[model samples]
Target: MNLQAVKILFLKDLFLSRRQLFAYFAAGLASSALTTIPNPTVSFVGFLLMITVAIASGIHLIGTLMLSESTDQTRLFVMSMPISLLDYSVGKIAVILTTYLIPWSAMFASSAILTFVLPTSKHGSFAVLPAIFLFLLCAFLIQLVTAVVSESVGWTISVMVGCNVGLNVFFMQLFASPEISAAAKSDSVSWPPVLIQLLTVELLIAAGALVTAFIAQTRKRDLV
Candidate 1:
C-alpha cells in the first residue's frame, strides 16, 4: 500500500468534507438542545430528532465521499493522480468513517447523558438508547459497505430503506420482549445474554462487510 499517497488522498477528502462536517456538528448541537428540555414527551421527540440527524449526516457524507467518486469525471480525475486504486479505497473509507464517527459519537454521548439525567418515573426507558445507537451504527456500516462495493445508487437506496424499516421493527420487538424491557428498566446497565448475542452478531456483520470491501478493492481491476 502507498502510505504517503493514502495520506494525501485522505487529507484531500477531509479538506473537501469540512463544510459537511460543520453542518453535522450544528445538527448535533440542535438535537442536544432539544434533548435538554425537561418534558418527557419533548425529550422523546428530541431523541427522534437526534436519530434523524445522525442518519441524514451519514447519508450526506457517504454521497459526498463515496458516491460522487463513482461519476465518470470524478473517477477520471482521481485515477489520473499518482495514487493506486487501493490507496484511494483506503483513504476514502478511512476519511468517511472517521468523519462520520465524530458526529455520531457526540450525539450518542449526549443522548446517554440525557437518558441518565431523565427522571425514572418519566423517561427511565431512555437507558435503551445506547443499544439503539449500536443498532443504528450497524445499519450505517452496512450502508457504507454497500456504497463502497456496489457503486450503484439503487442498491444503496434499497439498503437504506431496509435498514430504516428493519431497525424500527427490531426496536419495537425489543421493547415488546419481557426480558429485554426489564433489562432496559434496571437500576444499572444490564447486558443480558440475548442483548450481548445480538450486539455481537451486529459487530461481526459490520466488521465482515468492511473487510470484504477492502479485499474486493484490492482485487478490482478498474478504478472507474
Candidate 2:
C-alpha cells in the first residue's frame, strides 16, 4: 500500500467534503440537545431527529465522498495518480470514519454525559444509552458497506431507505420491552444477558461489514 497516496487521498476528500462534515456535526449536536429536553413530546421528537441524523450523516458522506467520487471528474483525477486499489479503499475508509466518527463520538459522549448527569436514561438505568448508541454505530457501518460495495445509487439508496430507519425503530422498541426495561431499572451495573448479547452481536456485525466492504472495494478492477 502507498501510505503517501493514502494520505493525499484523505486530505483531498476531507477538503472537498468539509462543509458537509461540519453540517453533520452540528446536526448531531442539535439532536443530542433535543433528546435531553425534559418534555415527553419534545424528547420523542429528539429521538426521531437523532435517528434521522444517524442515517442522513451516513448517506451524505457516502454520496459526497464515495458515490460522487465515481461519477465526477474528481474520480478521474484520483485514478490518474499512482494509487492502488488497496490504497484507494484504505483512503476512502479512513476518510469515511474520520468524517463520521469524530462528530458521532462527540454527540454520543455528550448524550452519555447528559443521560447520567441529568439522569434521563429511559428506565432510569444508564445501560440503555450504550445499547442505543451501539446500535446506531452498528447500523452506520452496515450502511457504509452497502454504499461502498454496491456502488449502485439505486441499490445503495434502497438499502438505506429500507433498513436504517426501520432497524433503529425496532431496536428502540426492543429496549423498551418490559423485560429489558425491568432489568435495566433493577440493576444498573449488572445488565441482563440479553442486552449484553445484543450489544455483542451489533459489534460483530459492524466489524464483519467493515471487513467485507474493504475486501470488496479492493477486489474491484475499477473504482466504481
Candidate 3:
C-alpha cells in the first residue's frame, strides 16, 4: 500500500469536511446550551436540533468524503497514483470514520454532560439521552457500512432515511417506556434492564457493521 498517498487522501478528505463538521459541532453545542434553560418548548427545539446535527453531519460526510470521490474527476487521478486498492480502501475507511467521529464525539460528550447536569424533570430519564446518542451512532454506522459495501448513493440515502425514521420512533418509545418515565423522578442515572439491553444491542450493531465494512473493503478488487 502507498502510505504517503493514503495520508494525502486522508488529509484531503479531512480538509473537505471541516466546514460541515464545524457547523455540526456548533449546533450540537447550541443544543447542549439549550438544555441549560428550563423551557419545555425551547428544550424540544433543542432536542430536534441535536438530532439534526447528528444526522446532517453523517449525511454530509458520507457524501463529501466517501461518495463524492467516486463521482469526481479525482477518481481517475487517484487510481493512476502510486496507491493500490488497499491504500484507497484504507484511506476511505480512515478518513470517513475519523472525520465523522470528531463531531460525533463532541455531540456525545455534550449530550452526556447536559443529561447529567440538567434536572431529571427537564431531560427525563438520564440514561435515555445517552442511549439515543448511541442509537444515532449505530444508525450512522449502518449508513457507513451501506455506503462502503454498496458504493451506491441511492442505497445509502435509502438507509439513511429509514434510519432517520427509526430513530424518531426509537426516541419516542424510549421516552414513553414505563422504565424511562418512572426514572425521570430519580436524581441518579437509571440503567433499567431493558434500556441496558438496548444500549448493548446498539453497541454490537455499530461494531459489527464497521468490521463488516472493513472486511468488504479488504476483499474488494477496486475502490475507485
Top-lDDT structure, candidate number = 1
What are the clashing pairs of model 2? none
Q: Which ranges in model 2 have alpha carbons more than 4 Å from their true place?
A: 119-124
Prediction 1 global C-alpha lDDT: 0.82
Roughly what TM-score does model 1 have, to 2 decimal places?
Answer: 0.92
What tens digits encode model 2's per-residue C-alpha lDDT throughout 131-181? 777777777777778877886788888877777666858676876777677
lDDT of 1 by residue, 33-82 (tens): 78778787886787788889888987888888898887645867888988
TM-score, model 3 to reference: 0.89
Candidate 2: residue 2 lDDT (0-100): 88
Task: Give lDDT tens digits, candidate 3, residues 11-87.
Answer: 88778778877787787788767866788888788777877888888888888777887788676787797777777
Distance from true position, residue 79, model 1, in Å?
1.2
Per-candidate alpha-carbon RMSD to the true structure: 2.0, 2.2, 2.2
Give candidate 3 misplaced runs (Cα > 4 Å).
1-5, 119-124
RMSD of 3: 2.2
